[model samples]
Target: MSTFLSALAGGALIGTSAALLLILNGRIAGISGITAGAVMPLSRDTPWRWAFLAGLLLGPVLYRLAFGAWPVVQLDAPWSLVVLGGLLVGYGTRLGGGCTSGHGVCGLARLSPRSIAAVATFMAAAAGTVFLVRHGGW
Candidate 1:
């Protein structure tokens, strides 16, 4: 498949899954919230959270099994930097009320003003980070 087609398919799958989650479970498909709930239970919603997290972890492996090749992933940063980045992102998701999938996909689909603002902020921050990384010495 061409890159565009593959990306379109991936996006369609993501949107469909998010829609299905909302329709069937009456829950937003927020990965960060799901992960946190899985780690620390607040109610009786633990099982589905665990299942969702497991699917996320196993998606690539299943794809590899079906395709006979692992998906390509490129990591240019050091392990320490990667870990730090992940930690920062986790923190940011909590602070901002949702992750990209939640705000950018599900929330936006619901025509939420908060999600629009969050997405705009996320995009600006990402653009600035890329600029600083590529042009300015970090």
Candidate 2:
């Protein structure tokens, strides 16, 4: 019951943000695009994006301070690995023309064929990577 409630709350928050972004900006709240814009912003067009990204970056810090611990289990992976993974994900998002939220939620909801294919490919790649890491060890 607690877990379900927590998940429901999280989902509601995500849906609300998505709806708000669509309504306010006619844009999907896709992190990749948001981060890119912040890094290489359009002239005089950056505050909202920066604020959004800042919230995302600061949310966990606030959570840690508020709760004394994050809800999820922690991983001991190297910081370099995590940074590399983020970079790779950013690159992949560009290659795929959007990130998971854009393609998986917004695009699929809109019945986009390209998003369907892109998401399928992303899933397959993720599965394959996990398999290789866990079993193949190659």
Candidate 3:
């Protein structure tokens, strides 16, 4: 499949899963929230949280099984930089009330003003970071 088609399929799956979670479970499919809940789960929330996280972890495996090859991923950053970036993203998710999947996909679909602002902020910050990294020698 072409890159565009793959992206479209992935996006459709994400939206469908988010919608199903909302409709069937009356929950938001925010990765951070789901992960946190799985970590410190209420008795009632444990099963679904684990299931959601398990699916997330196994998605690539399933994809590889079906496609007969794992997706190619190239990481240019150092391990320390990657770790720092993950920590920063986790912190930002907590501070921003949601992650990109939550705000950009589900929240935006719901026409949330807060999600709009958050997504805009995220995009702007990302653009600024890329600019600084590429041009400012950082």
User: Which predicted model would earn the best TM-score?
Assistant: 1
Please tell me which model should have the higher TM-score, number 1 or number 3: 1
* Candidate 2 Cα deviation (angstroms), residue 49: 0.5
Q: Which lDDT values do the candidates have, in the order given?
A: 0.90, 0.83, 0.89
Q: Which ten-residue region of model 3 has the weakest summed lDDT?
A: 36-45
In terms of TM-score, how similar is model 2 to the real structure? 0.80
Name the weakest run of 10 consecutive residues (lDDT summed) in model 1.
32-41
Candidate 3 CA-lDDT value: 0.89
Question: How many Å off is the CA of 98 in candidate 1?
Answer: 0.8
The C-alpha RMSD of each candidate to the native structure, in angstroms, is 1.2, 2.6, 1.4
Q: Please give, for residues 1-138, the per-residue lDDT of candidate 3 as tens digits.
A: 899999999999999999899999999988877876788775676799899988998999999999999889999998998999999998888789888888888789999999999999999999999899899888
Question: Comparing 1 and 2 by lDDT, which wins?
Answer: 1
Q: Which stretches of candidate 2 lie over 4 Å from their true place?
A: 1-5, 61-68, 78-84
- Please list the residue runs of candidate 1 whose C-alpha ends up more than 4 Å from where it truly belongs after superposition: none
> lDDT score, residue 119, model 2?
89
